[model samples]
Target: MPHLNLTRALTAGVLTLVASQALAHGDVAPQAVDTTGLPAIEGDWLTENPYRAEKVGEETWQRAIEIGASGYNQNCARCHGLEVVSGGLAPDLRFLEAEEYGDEWYVERFREGYTQNGITKMPAFGELLGQEAAWAIRTYIEARPDEGALDDFAEELKAMRDQMEGYIADASGADTEALKTRLTEISAQIETASGAPVADSVAYRAANLIDGSAEAFKSASEVLTIGLSAAH
Candidate 1:
């Protein structure tokens, strides 16, 4: 057999990590995509985005799914789920960025965290995986079928709302202009969701998603309308 080169070896290592992680988190399911007519995995794996490139057209989407699946399983399954679904213990990785934040938000959280509140368990992965590797992981998650572009946009909106709530809480003696900026962003989200007025319970849940006061709760409604509109 031809000897495995360093790149091949690294690719193998990456795949193995995803497989183990998915299995560990109970996210593993039978391959969803049909691989019967797909081409074999081959050649250098480099692409515009290394993480985004799976195995090329032979397997293409399937191969990408596998690599992403495995990588996510290894590094993220523990918290995000076997297949990016939520385990109820941690935020659902599939719908996270899809529902409340954008790629930049996800990237920032990957570097920093949900908030500086010190109450969340999410740890920054900047150290373990260089930015490229992190991006790869993100690509894998994004490739999964669970999240659509709208979902991605919605996720970003929610992140803004959550961030705004935090700002409102800490704004007592803080910068008024900053608060205004946050309000503007929040209003945008509300506009997006205007048609989808949430049920009282859902609205309440949405309200509680971020910590704040009665006044802040009122503000969240205005922002939610913008988010809802944006989503539509």
Candidate 2:
């Protein structure tokens, strides 16, 4: 619950501090994140992530995470790594807390960016993406499962994915409800490094996609396949 506490040092260090010179941040142009389904946010920027499930309801929060995943992968993944995990080139943002303190550091860096030795390591994203995208990305960042949070359930999840794959081939005997229930249980057990109440892990995502339909099973199976592959 502490420096998984990036409050103080982060404000003065973290992304603002030194990094590898070989870092490749790619295009200077920020990618456009489509936040069509999310609620529009305007005016002054918020200090806290307004899209958290508590503030905006679970439905909106989930939507924000979905939209935010796209934004982060496109704009922040090169240095920050996918799912907010860092590769030593940039700060690992997953542990940044979900409170006002962490939010302040994040908003500042995200808006002002950082530079060292005349190189633009982090580009100012506030203008290009706007508030909705910012908060959506924030939501996704805080919802990331902690490193190895799924390790305990890996084998079970793999077996479940295989079962779901079978259901995809033929859904006549699919125990879709059971699959969704088990996935939801696994998701609940996974913890977010940011200390957010819930994590938007693969199990949570796939569980939501499951609805006792062939298309739903296929979609869930694909999510599991990709997420598991990425985990390793």
lDDT of 1 by residue, 1-232 (tens): 2322223433443354444323332232222222232233344322233332332432344344445555566667775665455445544444333222335556665655432223334555555544545544555565433223235346545655555555554645434354345544433343111111111121332334333454654476455555355334
Q: Against the correct fold, how does model 2 do in TM-score?
A: 0.91
Query: Mind giving the per-residue lDDT tens digits that candidate 2 earns over 45-66?
Result: 8888889998889999989998
* Runs off by more than 4 Å, candidate 2: 7-19, 24-27
Candidate 1: list runs displaced more than 4 Å: 1-66, 96-101, 114-120, 147-232
lDDT of 1 at 123: 57
Clash count for each candidate, listed in order shown: 41, 1
What are the root-mean-square deviations of the candidates from the true structure over C-alphas?
Answer: 18.3, 2.3
Candidate 1, residue 101: the lDDT equals: 32
Local lDDT at 177 for model 1? 50
Best by lDDT: 2
Least well predicted 10-residue stretch by lDDT in candidate 2: 8-17
